[model samples]
Target: MGTWEAVRRGRLLIALLVAAAAIPPASSAAATTLPKKAKASSPPELLSELPVHAGRLVPSSVVFPIYGDVYPHGLYYVVMNIGDPSKPYFLDVDTGSDLTWLQCDAPCVSCSKGPHPWYRPKKSKLVPSGDPLCAALHSGIAQGENSGQCDYEIQYEDRGSSLGVLLYDAFSLRLTNSTRASPILAVGCGYDQQSAVQDASAPTDGVLGLGTGKVSVLSQLSNQGVTKNVVGHCLSGKGGGYLFFGDDLVPSSRMTWAPMSRIGFRNYYSPGPAKLYWGTQSLGAKQIEVVLDTGSTFTYFESHPYQAFLSAVKSDLSKTPLIEEFDDSALPVCWKGQKPFKSVSDVKKYFKTLALDFVKGKRALLELSPENYLIITKHGNACLGILNGSEAGLRNLNVIGDISLQDHMVVYDNEKQHIGWVRAACNRLPNADDHGLEDGDLSQYASMGVLK
Candidate 1:
């Protein structure tokens, strides 16, 4: 599966912002100072065994504070401390991809400018080529029996790529139960990185893949008994949110859930077929499968659904003073008012709320208000955040991106094979008492057999 599809879209957004003059010019000092390089280390010997394990007393849940925003950054990121000394690196959080990777200082052939220094792996941390995790990275390719460094290469649909070797490193984490744990996990040490659009301002050091594949960080943590094989995130529209591993933050009630679709690729979180609706009216589009991807900056719909959605919105705006703004290059579709729109609330009166009524799991309904699908550009015009997936080479795939996920607690319950969501005030983290779980109590979790 392509891991950087959403990242490529984010780059597209960056290019658009540059074109619209939304991004300010950098100072001479900031532009001239390049990221420092690190020396390359020799490949290490094969690991005899996986060294990480979580005891029965380990916490069931861990939460990380998320930084960055969808508007200026086009992504949300989390800082993770890795390696023996625990160096922090900013990772763009992506739920669509599987393998977690960091740009390495192994004398990188080509690398993007990031906020932190390159990750230098130790000589003893290299993963062997004969490992099963290495085989997963080489899926569909024939592998030899020779034992050496586990080399990997990933190419994105947007022509971005990474060449790297796999390694195991310590991830220092503090659980919500006030316990600290260090888990050794597999990670890609990318020695070379290339992108279709080179944005020096993009601050991500690498990707934090949260997909359902066995190679995902979440799955590895689950296997090591660090936390349950579940993950959730709440991305605020205003900025900054929280990401948690396990079910401690999940509400006991008042959350709508839909079964995860098993029909498609395994890495994505697909919530089966859903019919499109404009308020209460059906848009006459066929039921479209939706994948919740945190990596993408904007929502994408299949061709038919996208066209129907565009027409419905245009028809509703016919009676209003809002006119199509073709000059705005920020987004494909945008509308300008009598005066420039200061926010989505300024022009929301002209548009109706859109909903996706799922055909499965109690017919769960996902409502998207104007603010959810409209972005107020730097030009002060409201632009449509929903794009045509086919045009972006997604073909029939429909994606629910960050724009539509604002202010919602989205949960991916891999252990239960379902996805859940509820409207939330994402500005703050939920208290332990709010979820009915007292501090330092794993008894309830043990009763459910989730805790060891």
Candidate 2:
């Protein structure tokens, strides 16, 4: 499934501790053989002393698998090297899903086994017996050596799951030429996983969440001082983008700043808001709130605003014939006839720019034209990436998912308690002497009222 569709369809595997209400009891939800936990917190949250930093960028290689064009663009995969021999593992890069887990050699009831050999922690020096840190990760009742290891279970809304032991291990960011090392970070050694889609040969090892969740790989790195608690990703609409850690990834001077805020946790781990104004004709003249989520695959809104957005968008396309019955897209809304246009390039001119407007009238405009959110499928049909959030089970908030984030440098700055973005052609942005937008201008966004 496409990343956006995955979020809507609920094809997710969020950690049990991160979203306990969404999952089952840790013991009953996972393998029956190993020790179980009545409840569990992510390893990073359990950590009292954060690890030290080496100061480097961890580059994980990503591959965009082709889901149907009807679906939003596909999800990316991360390849990491683990263990003493540094075996390679293919996993998904999910920003909202935390816990870096891998399919283990232990055992499984109904999981599709990957081609790579399962990682056996016995040989690795990363986790030793009687370590308090590992004990802190313990779940259910602690058994003995082979069993007392920290247990973790992640159950998805769709009923798929990965339950297993947790491990702190050496990980390498797989890069060309040379590999960068990392201090031991928390990783879920998932031995058993239930796959919604079969063909064991095809399943990704596990997910690597690069989100704000405390246990997330991004947070783990930051807590350890490898980099500041900052993360950024630039996904290209055409394909191929980069994910980075640390200030050196992009110079602060080159970025345009905007205040990014989150409502006090829960109501779904967290709901983020971005104030903006969108319109073409008489519609979209008022300010709107969209939830910033990498977990969601597309943009969405309530029925009222959806109609406004649709009408506003339709008013501008005088030349393009929009086919309403686009069966190719998994999204609720899609159109065709804009193609003879492979990709969205040909139809981009007719689309509009979406602006991020603040209280002081300071605006950060993002071009959400076809080049950004429209997917021209292999079937030659053009699919609009934005959908109705209400139909997708989002009630109180509109979503600004990955599709809308394409081609932009989005920065998640937890240290300064701010977030910002700027449009850039390259995934690897150039360093700037003066980083960030003017502080006073950013205050406009910082001061806007939050939705939640």
Q: Which candidate number maximizes TM-score?
A: 1
- Lowest lDDT sum, 10 consecutive residues, model 1, at 14-23
- CA RMSD, predictions in order: 8.9, 9.3
**Which pairs clash inside model 2?**
4-297, 36-140, 37-140, 70-328, 70-329, 70-330, 252-435, 253-434, 253-435
Query: Model 1 over residues 249-355: C-alpha lDDT tens digits?
Result: 88888889999986453467888989999988899857898888887778999899999999999999999999899877667788888887788889888889899
**Shift of residue 135 alpha carbon in model 2, Å:** 12
lDDT of 2 by residue, 1-452 (tens): 22333433324333334322122224443444333322333332222122333743443211112111124435545456665456767666555555677776554444565647666654232232234434333322233443334555666433467766666665644221122444557777776676655443533566766656665666766765555676666665655455556554455465665555554442122223334434434334555555455554566676677777777676666456765654653545556774455757666666776554543213544446556567665566666676766664555556666677777767767666556677765333334223332322212222111110
Return the TM-score for candidate 1, rounded to 2 decimals: 0.84
Looking at model 2, which ten-residue stretch has the lowest summed lDDT?
443-452
The candidate that wins on lDDT is: 1
* C-alpha TM-scores of all predictions: 0.84, 0.71
* Clash count (model 1, backbone only): 0
Which stretches of candidate 2 lie above 4 Å from their native place? 1-33, 36-73, 113-115, 121-149, 155-160, 173-180, 195-203, 266-272, 279-289, 318-320, 358-362, 427-452
Superposition error at 272 for model 2 (Å): 4.9
